[model samples]
Target: MAVAAIAGGTFAFKALDKSVKLVVDGKTQSVSTYASNVEGVLKDANVKVVKRDDLTPKLTAAVADGGTIVLNRARPLAIDIDGVHSKKWVTAYTVEEALSQLGIDGGADVSASRSQRLPLKGASLEVTTPKTVAINVDGQAISVVSTGATVKDVLDAQSISLVEGDFTTPAVDTPVTSGMQVDVTRVRTTTTQEAQPVPYSTSEQPDGTMNKGDKKVVTKGVAGEQVVTYTVTTTNGVVSAKTQVSAQVTVAPVNEVVNVGTKEAPVAAAPAPSGSGAGSSGGGSNAGAIPSSGGLNWPALAQCESSGNPKAVSPAGYMGLYQFDQRTWNANGGSGSPLDASAAQQTAIAQNLYNARGISPWPSCGPKLLS
Candidate 1:
């Protein structure tokens, strides 16, 4: 009985010592044996902790019974995702496992290695990874963007717009990867009036009878215009650059002016007939008298042509009341060289007779001669 009591007492002492209560986060838990540390206890309870998570009582600290020990694990992970800040917590044993457990994919920009071992107590891990994408705007190639998750995310990062008629190198819906390119081209129309100075030119009338100062219409003055299409590149809703892709002329210009006249005079008229002349019927009143009915000034003509000297002889070999040359006097049917009044009157009568018959050598000046 003594041996049995001693063994039972020893077993009871050991059992009491092993059965200790642990206080964690205000919750009490009973353990039958000593564990390595709080981290081991949390692992046994299937509680997951990440490097970014808050924790109390470090993993390296020893556990004490009834000491109100807090089994808080640390799980801290800092992620730089396309210039964005992000954090995650995981109880995974490796970087790859941690990301997977946190619903992160292999395509994500993760800085740490997938097979990299981590501390059991959890430590802060920096993931400096970036998703690469190609960008093209308005037919211009841009450098690959390093950090973006979705198409919209990539555009937002680059401040690019996705509008209708805009083209993309890689469709906007395409997934982003390393060195992937995305292009955007927007369609635009521009209207412009281009005024070209048309040089003036002179034109003649249709009638062929034009003079030096006369002018006519060559081209009417009309305004010219053109319409063009362009592809513009924009960033942050502002136009960055533009390129003309197509153009067309909408209107053409015409020129305009007034006209002036420049012409020479026509010929003169012939002398009147003797019998049909404007004179009195009586021979005594009209035979030796100048006609007064015609608009011609006989006195002025006599003074200018013969200088009141019907018998005068010019040094140029001309004679008679009109100073006619020998050839002209003969052509006009003058009887002889008229050096006196009577001879001049007779010669003038003969010339007038020939002029009335339309047999004179001079061109008829009826159009331009003054009465």
Candidate 2:
């Protein structure tokens, strides 16, 4: 009976004394206690356990031999939700648990990953709740719930496609905000013709046959008309880009060709006497050079008519420097063809004809000899 009492007393003393380890947040401490329960042990260590704090072994449970009691103090975790600053007191182990404990669900996007454990001192996490946004495509508006960060992401999320000549308002690279208005414009191009004036070109050539210092227009230039086809792109009733596709000339341009004379001027002859008379039958062929008669200049008129060549002929079978036909030469007291007569004889006959006819013949080229 004495040995049994001693054994029971030893067992009772061993039960009263327990070895336990306490871990608060990340810190650890050892405590040798005679407390019988977790509450008693917490009382001995001067640790007050609250309902919000986490405990590995519950405070109401009996203390175990060499067992651990982990106390994670509840802390308020800051949350940024839709630009609203909020906080939730939690005792969860990781980011996912914390959100779940706070009644946050519905596949919410957390700035921090779910696997990331809570630190000793809690950190912040951003919760972005997806919202519906309206997108305008080709003047049609459509609404969709999206968690996209940019306009392009939202369009791709909805399986919207974009091709060449397609554009969007607020730009496709811009970040999407809640209730943001997105406009998409479709561009179409067409080939069109526009009439345009084509300028004419000028060309010059040297002409040795024309009189020296003389200018002539070989061909007159005219400005032509042409139609140019352009590839024009229009976006929602607005012009975007234009480029020439093809060109056609309806009226071809005429180039101006001008003749530039390079010929040498003829040398002026000695002035004949103003009173010099034509040869009479009495004086023979040694007649003085006649300059003018009856208010008519003979020498200059003969020069203009036939370039002062006494043996010159006309296309109408006219003869002599005075351009007379055979019948006219005989009527003017000329015996044979005017080509057979000497310059003095031809001049005498021309003077007689001029005196009688009063300079009515040779009107076209004769007026230029007045000066």
Error of 2 at 201 (Å): 15
In the range 1-371, model 2's lDDT, one tens digit per residue, is: 99999999999887778788988765688888998788888888888888789887887788877978888778779997755788788887688878888877657678888988787477898876676789888667899887776789889988888888788888898867788888888888888899999999999899987543345688999999999999999987688899998889999999899886676534334232232221111112222343343345667766656656565665566666577878888987899687677666676677667655656666754664465
User: What's each prediction's TM-score?
Assistant: 0.30, 0.44
lDDT of 2 at 74: 85
> For model 1, how does the per-residue alpha-carbon lDDT over 1-371 read when each residue is reduced to its tens digit?
99999999999776544333555433568765445566665665556655655456766666555433444334556655444577665555567777777665566655566777666445555443466566766656667545465566678777778666565656666656667766576754333333333344444344234332233344554555666666665653567767877666656444444343344212222222222111112111111232211233332333334443444455565553344566665554555665534523533443343334432321232221133
Q: What's model 1's TM-score?
A: 0.30
CA lDDT of 8 in candidate 2? Answer: 100
Clashing pairs in 2: none
Error of 1 at 202 (Å): 15
Provide the lDDT at 172 for model 1. Answer: 65
Highest-scoring model, TM-score: 2
Candidate 1: global Cα-lDDT? 0.49
